[model samples]
Target: MTNYHDPIKHLNFLRQTLSLDKKPIGFFVSAGCPLSVEMPKGEWPLIPDVAGLTQYATQELGSKDEEPYNDYDRLLKEVVKSEKDPKNIEDILSFIRSLKVVAVGNDVRGFNIDALSEIEKNICEKIVEKLDVDLPSENSPYHKLAHWISIDRSVPVEIFTTNYDLLMEQAFEDISIPYFDGFIGSRQSFFDLRAVEDDLMPDHWTRLWKIHGSINWFQKENKDVFRTTRTDEINSSHLIYPSHLKYDQSRKMPYLALIDKLSKFIRKPNSLMIMTGYSFNDEHLNDTILNALKSNPNTMVIAMLFGDLTYKDDNGDVIENYPNAVKLARNRSNLAIWGKDEAIIGTVRGHWHTMDDDFDDSINLANSITFVQKEGEDGEETDEKIYSLNLGDFSKLGEFLQALIGYNQTNFDEN
Candidate 1:
C-alpha cells in the first residue's frame, strides 16, 4: 500500500539530476490526469474531465434508434477498440473531420458536415469556457511548476501542451510570470512564425507552444489567424479540430515551427524532459521523444503516467496488462518512468530496471529509510541521522512539485 502511495524516492532522484546549467528542460502536458482531478468545490469542474467528455460524446451521437447517430456511435467504438486508448479524443475528431471532407461533392452520401461540426464546436466551447475560469487559490501544481521555473532566473523553461485550455497561461499570468506564445503584439495577438523561429529569443523568457491549435484561434477572411474570447459561435474555428490529422496539419506554418523547436531542443546533450498527463496517444509526439533518446545519449525523459501503461501485442492490439514505459525503459537506458507507486529507473549498465519486485531497494520517501534493513540486525535504532521528507499528499502534481521544491531547498540549505 505504501509503495503505491509514495513518490519521494522518485522525487529525490529527480532533484539530484536537475541543474540550472543543464540544457533546457521542457514540460509536456496533456489533457488527462492533472486536468481530470477535481478541484475544490468553489473551483469544481475547472476543466472538462473524462466522465464529462464521455457523456458529451454520448449525447452528441444521440439515440441508438437513429441510424445516423448509431453510425457515429459505432465509429467512436471502433476507433477506441482499435487504438486501445480510452481517452483518445483526437482520433474521434479526426474521423469526423474526414467524414465531412469526404461528404463534399458527392464523395460520401450519408455523412453531414453540419452535424459533425456541431459536435466538434460543442466540445471546443466547453474547453474554452472552463479554461477561462478564474484561477483558484489552492495549491495549484501549475503555480508550483512556474515557481520552480522562476527559481532558475538564468534560463526560462519551455512548456509544450497538447491541451487547448488556458490553465498554464492563467497560472503564469496569476503569478506575473512572463511567457512567449509565438504570438506577436498586444491589442490583437496574431500568429508570428518569425518570432517563434527567431534565434535571438531571450533565454530568460519562458516559451510556450500549443502544438494543438487553441480554441481562441480563428482564421479571418484574409486567412490570417486571430485570437478571440468569443465562444458563442466557433463552427468555423481555425483550430486543427482535435484530430490525428494534427500530424499532417502540424507540417504547416506555426505548428511546424513549434514542433521543430521541440525536436531540436531534445536533441541537445544533457536535455531532460518531464512529460506529464500525456497518454502516449499522439504518435507524432512519441516519435519525437523516441528519436531524441536514440540520437542524444545524455538526454533523459521522466515520463509520469497517471494510469496503467499500455503496449501493442504482435497482432497490434493494445495490451493493458504490461507497463509500456517499463518495457521501453528496458530498451532505452536514458528514460525513467513513474506511474502510481511503480517506477522503472535507469541503471548503471546499459539497461533499465527497478529496485526489485517488492521495491525494497528503493528509498522510502517518508523518512528516507527503506523497508529493507540489515539482514541480521534486530529491530534496533541506528545512530546514523536519516533525512526525512514529508509529502503532504501523493500522486498529484502539487505534491510532486512540492516534494521536488523541498528536496532542492534542502540541498541549497546544506550547501
Candidate 2:
C-alpha cells in the first residue's frame, strides 16, 4: 500500500521544485490540534485549579445556595433546547463565556472519581492524562518541522500557537531547540520584565508567539508584567482563559503591543503560513489571519482539515459539504490540505479505544483516520486502496518541515 506518511520524500520533491528562500515560512497551531503523545494509564491526576471553577459554578447554580442564581444554567438549558429567546440565549452565552475557566475548574472538581461509572471515570482520566503528558517527540509534526528547519535553512522560523498547553514548548525544550515567546528574561531582572531584551535573544532559535496565552503564563501584581513557567505552585490569578471577549480584552496596551509585533512578523514579504488543528472559530483571530493573508499575495497557507470533513446546519441539512475542508479551501489562493486520511495506529490506537466518549476520546478517534489511494501500471486506473503513513500522518511532520527547508535552500542557491 502507498505510504501517505512519508513527509521526507514529499519535502525532497517540493525542494526540487519550489522557490522557498524568497519567503519565510511559519506554523500556527490551535488547541484542538492533536499534537499530544499517548499518556500512560493513571489515577486521578491533579487537575489545574483553574478547571475547578467550572465545578464550583455548576454546583452553586444547581444547589439552593445563598449565591444568587443568575438563571445562567436555565438559560443554557433553554438555549440547548432551542426554546430560549435569541436575546436570552446571547446573554446566557455571554455569561457562560465569561465564566468558562471557572466553570471548567468546577466541573473537574465536581467529578466524584470514586462514584463515577467505569466509562465516565475513564473519560475523566483520559483528559487528565492528556493534560499532564508532554507531546511525543517522535510523533509530533511541529517538532519534526522544527528539526528540518534547523538543519536545512538559515532563515529564522516563527511559531505561533493558540494552545494553552505546553506540548509545543516541551517539544522544543526536549530537542534543545531554542525558542522565544516573549516570556523569558534575565535572572537578575527576570521577575520585573515581561520579555527578554532583543540583543540577548539568540539568532538560531524559533520565536514563539502565544497568541491566546499559555497555561504557564501569569500576570504579576496589577502591573502588565508577565511571568514564565515555574515549577512552584501556580498562582490562580495569572491564567488566561479562552473566551469570546479575550481578544477584545487583549487590545489593551500591553497585549496590543504584542499583537502589533506579531502582526509585523506576518506582514513580512514572501511569508508562507502552515496552520494545523485550528478550528477557525475565533472571529478576532480570523480577522487577524485574513488581514495578514490580504496584505501578502505571495503568502501560502497549508491547512490540515481533521475529522469527517462534513457538517450540518440548524435545519439538519448539509448546507455546507466538507465544512472545515471547504472553508479552508476557499480562504486562500495558494493552499494545500492534509490529514484528511491519516490515522493513529499500534499502541496509540489501543489506548484510544480504552477511553470513554469524551473530547479527548473523540480527538483520538479523529486522529485515527488515514489517507489512502490506489495506483496502476502506466496511466491505467485500478481499485483504490487506503495508504497509511505516507505524506499526511504525524510521522511525516519532520519531513514536511524539511521539505520547506529544502525549498528555501534551493531558492537561496538560485539567487
Candidate 3:
C-alpha cells in the first residue's frame, strides 16, 4: 500500500482551520527561531543556534593558563565524560546545578563547592551574554509574528516558547500588543501561579509563556522571582529551568507551573498547536506533549520540522527516522510532522503530492513550500524534482501568516 501526503489539501485544511477557528490556537516557538537573525553583513546570525552556542561557550570557558579559570575546563570534562552530547550547554548546566545542590560542604566530582559554583557562574554568564541580542528592526520575523497576533481575531493567539531570549518581548512591545507571562503587578512583576491557574485575563491579551525561563528573570533574597528590564537590577543568576532536568527538581515551582500550562492548552477541545524551530531533543517536553495528545483527541499538534522526518537506507528500507516524533505519530492520528522533504500524517510517512495538476502555487505552496530542481551530491541540478516545505523556519512561517491574514505582504521586506 502506497501512502502519500497531499500538500494542497493539507494547506487548504490549514487555511480553513485558521480562518474559522473559535478554539485555542497556539504557536510553540523554540530555540531555532533566533537562528533567522543575520548580522549587518548577512554573514552569520546575531544569535547562534544551540550547536553554535554550545561551541562558543566551550571556547569561551576553556582553560587559559594565563587566567585562573582553569577549573571550568576540568569541571566540564568531568560533567560530560559519559554524556552522549558532550557539548550540550543545557545538560552541562543541569549536571553542574545537580552537583551544587548535593555538594553542600564537600567535594563532588573532584570539585569543591566553591569551584562548582564558580563554574556554574561562568556558564550562566556566557549563556546570558550570547542570548542578549536586540531584534534588528520592527520588520524582522519576530515582529511579523507580533503583527499576526495583533490582528483582531475571535481567540487571541497563545505563544508558548522554550527560548530565553527577549526577541518575542521586544516584538510585542514594538507593536503595542499586550501580553501576560504568568506574572502580575505594576511595579516589579512577580510570578503569580494563582493567576495562571485561574486564567482570568481577557482573550484579547495574548498569553506568552516561557516554559524554560528567561534571561531577564531574577530571584531576590526573599525568594521572590521577578522580571526586570534594567541590567543593573540583575542581582543574581537568571532563573532558567535547565536545573529542572534533574529528576529530584522536576517539580520545582514556576518551571512546573509553566509546563502545566502547555498541557492545559492542548487539552482544550478543538485546539491547534503549530510547533516551529524545535528540535524535539528535550524528552520531558516530548513526554508532556504526547501525554496531552492521548488525553485529548480533539487537539492537533502540527510539528513542522526543518528537515526530512525519515529517510531510506541503501537497501530502500525506511530505517532512519525521527525516532521520537515518528514513533509517536505512528499511533496518534492527531499528531502530524510536516517536514521539509516529507511528512508523517495519519500514521503514514511519504513525500508530498498535490491532487491539482495545474497547481497555481507550484512555485511553492503559500510562499512556504518550494518546488526545486533536485540537486545531486555534487550540488548540480539534476533531472529529478522535489518539494520542500519550510514553514518550520520562523521567517517563512511569519511570511505565511502575513499572507494568510492578507496583511502588508508587499512591504514586508521594506524595513
Candidate 4:
C-alpha cells in the first residue's frame, strides 16, 4: 500500500525530484471566486465619494425607509419613470453607472444582488458581513502565499489577476511584501518604460499583473495611476471606476503591451498555471489561456472547482463530463479538478483557522497522494487512495500552493 497520508514526506519527495528552483510557476487568479470574495451585487466598493452617491441613491429610493418602490417587479421601472425629464433620466443613469454594478456577469441574475440595483447592494452588504464574521481580513491567503513563495523559490513568483479590486495590493502591503505592478511607475508614458528598463527586474520583488483595470486605476492628464488610499483632492477624471473594454481602450498602447507581455510569460515552458475561482466566461481571456496551453502542451493547469464538476447539456440533462467541458477538454491530461468536499480533506490543520475542524485534512492528503500514485501505476491496484478532494475549504489554499510548489520542483529535477 502506498502510504500517501504523510504530507511532509510527499512534499519533500516531490521537491527532491522536481528541482522547482530552476523553473518558476505562474498564478492566474479569476476575480470571481478563488482569490476574490464574491460580492452579492458583483459590485466592489469604490472611492468614498462614489460610495456616498450610491448610498444616497439607495436611501432616496426608500431603501433606508424600507419602502417598496412599487411592489417588487416594478421598483426599477418606477424609479426610471419617476425621472420625467431627459436630464433627470441622464442623472439617474449616470448614478447607476457610477455604482459600478456592471462588473457582475450574467450568472448572478436571480440573486438579490443581480446587477447594480439597490437589492444587489443589500445582498453584497450581507455577504461582506458574513465574510467579516469569519476572517479578520481578506488579505489572509494572499499574504500567506506571498510570504511562503518568496522564501521558498529562487525566482520571484508572478501573479496575474483579473480582479478590479485593491485586495491583493492591500495584502501585499499588510505583509510588507514588495510587488511591482504594471501600473504605478508612470502615468503619461505611452509604453511600459519599466518593461524596457532592466530596473524592472528588481531582486526579491514579486510581479503583480492586474490584467483588468483596478478600482484605483485611473487615467488623468494623459497618464494612469493606481491609488489604494482615498483622496478627495484628486480630480474626477482621476477616479478609476469599474468599466468594460472602454477602460482597456483608455490605457491605449500601454494596456496592449502589457497583455502581450502576459501572453508571452504564460507560454513559457515547464510553467505551471494555477487558476482559482474563475468561471472561464470571458472569451478574450479564455482565448489567452487556450493559446498559452497550445504554446506549451506540457504545461499543467490546476483548477479549483468550487462546486460539482457536472454541467448541463443542451438538452438540460446533467452530464458527468466535468473538467471535460468543451473549453477545458483540449488540455485534459494536465488538468486537475478539486471540489469542495475534497478541499476540507486536503487542508492542513491550523494553517487556515477558518475551515471546519470536522473535515479530515490527513485523509485528504492521503487520498491526493494515492491519486497521483494510481495515475502513475497504469491502473494497477496500489495501496493509494484514488479519490479527489473538493475545493470549498478555504484553508486548502495554503496546502494546494505548497503541494504544487513541491510537485513542480520534483518534476523539474527529474527532467
Candidate 5:
C-alpha cells in the first residue's frame, strides 16, 4: 500500500545525468514552451498554441469570401462534420496532405489540388505571422535554456523542438552560442542531409533539429527544401506535417530524418532525454519514443508535464493526468513521467514524498517540492502523506537550471 515516489531520489538521478559532462543530454521541447513565456502586463503568449492557432485560423478563414476561403470553408465544415478530430490547423493541414498521398487525391471535397494548396497557404501564412514575434528579453526561459546549453560539456547538446517559431534560434543567437540546424550555405540555407547524418560538427556546436517544419523553410520548383532568414519569402505548401500517411518522398524529408534522429539519439548508451511542455498528444512521436525506450534499456526519458499527475473529478474520482503518458511510463523502467505534484519512475506511479532533511546541496531543492494540507470527511483539515512538486512549468524548470549553474537560485523559492 506504500506507493509514494521519492522526488529527491528521482531528482538525484536527473542531477547525475546533468552533472556528468560526458553523458549525452538532449531536450524535447514542445508547444507548452512558447505558451509558458510570460507576456508583459498580462498580454497573451508570444505565439498561440495549437488550439489558440486553430481558433485564430478559423476566424481568419471564416472572415474571407474569396475562392480559396470558400473552398477552405467547405472543406473545414465537411472535415469537422465527418472526422470530428481535426483539433488544430496543423491537424487540418495534415488531413489535407493525407488526401494528397491517397488515391482519392484532391477529389475528397470536390476541390482540386490548387484549392487545397491555397487553403494550406492561408493557414501557414497566418501561423507565420503570429509566430514571428521576438523574444521578450535576454532573461527569458529560452535564453536560460541557451545558457544551460552553453555550459561546459564533453558531448554536444541536442535540442529537438516541434515548434516552427524562431524563438529557440533567437535565444541561441542572443547569447552568441554556436549552433547548427541542418542547414548549410549562404543566405538561402539549403538542408544538408549529410551534415545531419554525419554530425561532424564540433561538440561545442549544438544540434537544433526542428522536427516540424519551420516558417523559414520553403520548397522550390524543383522540390528542394531550403531555409531562409526571411519568413515572408517562403511558401507554406512545402511545410511537412507528417501524420499517419506514409510516402516515399516524405520519408526522405527533414520530418522523417529529424524523427529518425530522435530515435537514434535515444538509442545511444547513457543517453538522457528531458522532455518539457510536451503532452502525449502526438501519437506518432509517442510511438517513436516508446519504441526507443524498449530498444534501449540504458537510456532514460524524463517527461516534465505542466500539471499534477492526478486530480479530483466531479464524481470525486482521482483522474490521472495525461493517462497515456503515465501508463507508458509505468510499463517502461527507463521512462519517467515528472508532473507537478507527483512522478512515475520505474513502473511506480505515485506522489512525491520528502522530508525537511532532504535538502543537502541547495536550499532551492526545498523550494521546488513542498507539502500541502489535506481535509478529512468531517470537513476538518488533516495531514497529508505526500508533497506538491512544482517543477513542471518551464519558468520553474528554467530557474532550476539556473540554480544548477550558480546564476540565480532566488527565483526557485519565488514565483
Candidate 6:
C-alpha cells in the first residue's frame, strides 16, 4: 500500500505545471500541512473535543458520569467499529452533526434532545478553542509564500485552502499583497457570489477560496455573514465544523460557489493543479479530483503526500505503507503521486511503474504527462526539492513553506 514517490520526480512535475500554458494557475493547501507554528499552551485543548465531552459527561453527569455522554460514546464506538480507516476528531464531530435530525423516531429507554444538543455545542466549542492557534509573529512562513505569489508575474494564480485559520489572511495583510476572497465591503464584508460567478477576478490578483468555513466568519440573526477577530463568540461562529454534514454544508452558498469554481478550474484546458497537505481522505474531495481528471484530458493533478499513505484492505485489515491514493492514481495517466520514498507517474495503462531502478526515466515519464520536454542530459533545469516532516507535526507547515520558498528561489535564480 506504499504510495511513496521520489521527491525529485514530484518536483519535476511541479516545475512543468508552473510552466504550463494555463493562464491562471491554482493550488490547494490542506490542513494536513500548515506553516509550522507553535500553538499557545492552555489556550487549546490537549485531547480530542469528543474526549473532553466524554470526560465531562462521565464526571459532571453525577453518579452516572457516563450517562450524559452514553449516546455520544456509543456513536463513537460504532464509528470506530464500522469505519475501515481509523477515525479522527473531525470524524467523530461529523457523525454527531449527522444525527441532529436523523436520530428521530427510534429511542432507547429515553431520548434527551437537550443533552445531545449540549454535547454538540460543547464539541464545537472545544474544537474552535483548540484550533485558535497563536499566529506566527516575526518571520512568518505564510508571509514569504504570499510575497512569492505577489512577485510571480509570470502566471496568474488562485489559492484554495481547507484550513479555517486566518494565518494566510494575516500574512497577506501584513505584506500588503492584494487578493480577493469572494467577500466584499470595507466595514461588513459579505459573500459576493456574483463576482465569483461572473468570473470577474483579474489575472494579476490572487483569489483565495476557503472551501471549508472559517473561524472568524459569523452569521447575524438576519443571516448576513461578516468576518471578525473575536474568538469568544461561540454562538456567532458560523464555521462548518468537522462533521459528516460537510457535504451538505458545501452545497450551501459560498461553499457551493467556491467548490464549483474549483471544479471548473481543473476542467479547463492546459490546467495543472498542485495539491499539498491534503490526504484525499474526504470522499467528496476525492470525487471532485477524479471527476476533474475524467472531464478534461489536458488537465493534470499532482498530489504530494506528507506522510506514509495507508488504507484498509478488503477484509478490513489495516494495511500500512499503502496509500488510498493508489486506487485513484492506478491506471490514470493524468494523476501522478509523490511521497516520502517512492514515485508513481502516469504511463501506459498496464503494469505498476516504479522509479527505484531508473530515476531519470521516471522523471522523464512524469514530465511527459504534462508535455514538458527535458533538456539534454547536460541541460540545466530549475532547482526543485521536496520537503518532509515528522509524523503528526502540524507545525511543519512553516518548514514546508520555507522549503517551497527555497525551491522556487532556486528556480528563479537558475531561470
Return the top candidate by TM-score.
5
**Residue ranges of candidate 2 with Cα displaced over 4 Å:** 1-22, 39-132, 136-139, 186-200, 230-236, 244-254, 311-325, 335-395, 399-415
Candidate 3: Cα lDDT at 195: 80
Runs of candidate 3 exceeding 4 Å displacement: 65-69, 243-251, 310-321, 361-365, 373-385, 407-415
Give the range where candidate 1 is weakest over 10 consecutive residues by summed lDDT: 385-394
User: Order of all candidates by TM-score, from best down to worst?
Assistant: 5, 3, 1, 6, 2, 4
TM-score of each: 0.73, 0.59, 0.89, 0.57, 0.91, 0.69
Q: How well does candidate 5 match the true structure, expressed as C-alpha RMSD? A: 4.4
TM-score of 5: 0.91
The lDDT per prediction is: 0.60, 0.47, 0.79, 0.47, 0.79, 0.58
Clashing residue pairs in candidate 3 are none
Residue 189 displacement in candidate 5 (angstroms):
0.3
Clashes (backbone N, CA, C under 3 Å), per candidate, total 0, 35, 0, 20, 1, 19
Model 1: per-residue Cα lDDT at residue 409: 47
lDDT of 4: 0.47
Cα lDDT of candidate 6 equals 0.58
Displacement of the residue 62 alpha carbon in candidate 2, Å? 7.5
Candidate 6, superposed: residue stretches over 4 Å from native: 1-10, 19-22, 35-87, 103-116, 137-140, 152-155, 230-237, 241-251, 308-322, 347-415
1 or 2, greater by TM-score: 1
User: What is candidate 2's lDDT per residue for 84-107, written digit by digit as tens?
Assistant: 332321233333444443544354
Evaluated at residue 70, the lDDT of candidate 3 is 76
In candidate 2, how many Å is residue 331 off?
Answer: 5.3
Off by over 4 Å in 4: 1-19, 34-139, 184-193, 196-199, 223-230, 237-250, 311-316, 319-326, 330-337, 340-386, 391-394, 402-414
